[model samples]
Target: MRESEYAESRADFVHQLRIAIKEANETQYWLELLHQADYINKKVLNQLIKTVLKS
Candidate 1:
């Protein structure tokens, strides 16, 4: 997130936003995987998903 703070150009800012969105999607994928595998509890999973989506 801080990477965008120092962006020197509009292109750089767009790049950073794209990267952040990709990473967030990837995080959601992993979180769902863990939940489906029974490696995470419902309460914790819900909290994590909420936090990720909010961000």
Candidate 2:
């Protein structure tokens, strides 16, 4: 691929990565809120936490 093509690909990757990170952060925030409000059981919350940490 040409140098410009490679640069464009890298930029797209970085943009996608930033979006994923933002969404993950938002998910964690919601999970925490749900747990605090007793909307989620301890076991389920623990499982979710483990899954999120692993990712």
Cα-based lDDT for every prediction: 0.90, 0.72
How many backbone clashes does every candidate have? 0, 0
In Å, residue 8's CA in model 1 sits off its true spot by: 1.0
Q: What is the C-alpha local distance difference test score of candidate 1?
A: 0.90
Q: Per-residue error at 19 for model 2, in Å? A: 0.5
**Candidate 1 stretches greater than 4 Å from native:** none
Among all candidates shown, the one with the greatest lDDT: 1
TM-score top scorer: 1
lDDT of 2 by residue, 1-55 (tens): 1223344577876776676667667777888889999999878888887777565
lDDT for 17 (candidate 1):
83
Query: Clashes in model 2: which pairs?
Result: none
Deviating ranges (above 4 Å) for candidate 2:
1-8
Candidate 2, residue 44: how far the Cα is off, in Å: 2.0
RMSD of each: 1.2, 6.2
**Lowest summed lDDT window (length 10), candidate 2:** 1-10
